[model samples]
Target: MAAAFLSRPVYPGLALVPQARRHIFALEGAGAGALTDLAPDAGALTRSDILYLPRDPDGAAQAVALAALGAASLWQAPDLAALLSRLAGLLDGARMGTRLYAAGSEGFIGQVLVVAEAAGIDPLSVATEHRGNRARRVQCVHCKTVAEEVTTQPCACPGCGLTLFVRDHYSRRLGAFQGVCIDAEEPGSAPAAEEAFR
Candidate 1:
């Protein structure tokens, strides 16, 4: 429980850093609303680049809305993988005064943080806000398989076939929560799986 509290990420929400020379936004699903709500000034929009991936049913509408915001460049990725790929390239070329902002689910934010870390961006300097479902990314401790969007406790490990107990101990490097086998001492005594993360 203490570990859970300690590891849980806090999102203070995204705001326009007025002093930044360039603004880079990484958005997924309902996360696009954060940027749209900011109502950035024309100068900021002219110096901003947005990479967005719509992950929900109303995603198309959101994409259209985001495109109309008139950022310097807006790329609508078809999927998360493509969005991340583009984000990597964008981060690689990011200038010194560029500010990174991400808004999405916790899992998506973690993935973004990982990318920024690799690009040598200080996590403290990146603005993050959580929006949308609470599904988590889980990494199996036994087989080291990282599962995406895990929504339940006692989730099955896709790699080692273990019934895992999802713990809140998160790894910034893995961008996932730790999942240890639930019944390792008594092989067949694991509790039933239940919806947890949503």
Candidate 2:
């Protein structure tokens, strides 16, 4: 069992909510594969709308595969912002009995949960599956700056210039992991950053 950090998210992977009348998928990068892997039935596919954002160039292929699923609609967002914007719009007009699924890196899923919350949806109710890129979004405790795609343990704060030690702790409201100064006890003694969450 994963450690039950009060705020840390635990992904249970994507499963079809059979009773749902409609389905919405917010997918990022290789995360699109999760849906394809599910092989939703024809009835589910006909009622599904997908919002996909490629994490990198390779994401184009995943987008293509998701398109072939024959979903009711598949939108390839140019960026995360575009995906979120479209998601917000869809949520605003969402009818009852709609189920949401999100998949991707931790950072990507965090942002998706934030959007879901803004739409008055319970973030916990959304199905999630962690996919490519374990890189995290870190927020500096001292400076309150959130950095995207942080892959190291001791990372430099882009906002306050602090050498922050990223922690496993996560914040659902902020959609980021906690980062604290690593050299606070002994200034300039922080260890060199090494890849930890690629």
- In TM-score terms, which candidate is top? 2
Q: Which ten residues in a row have the lowest lDDT in candidate 1?
A: 1-10
Model 2's TM-score against the true structure: 0.96
> Could you say which candidate leads in lDDT?
2
Candidate 2 lDDT over 36-65, as tens digits, reads 999999999999999999867788788889
RMSD over all Cα atoms, model 1: 1.5
Q: Model 1, residue 121: displacement in angstroms?
A: 0.5
lDDT for 13 (candidate 1): 97
lDDT of 2: 0.93
- lDDT (10s digit) by residue, model 1, range 89-185: 9989878899999999888999999999999998878899988988889999999999888998889999989999998788888889999999999
Count clashes in each candidate, considering only residues at least 3 apart in sequence or on different chains. Answer: 0, 0
| Inter-residue clash pairs, candidate 2 | none
Tell me the TM-score of each prediction against the true structure: 0.95, 0.96
Query: lDDT for each of the candidates?
Result: 0.90, 0.93
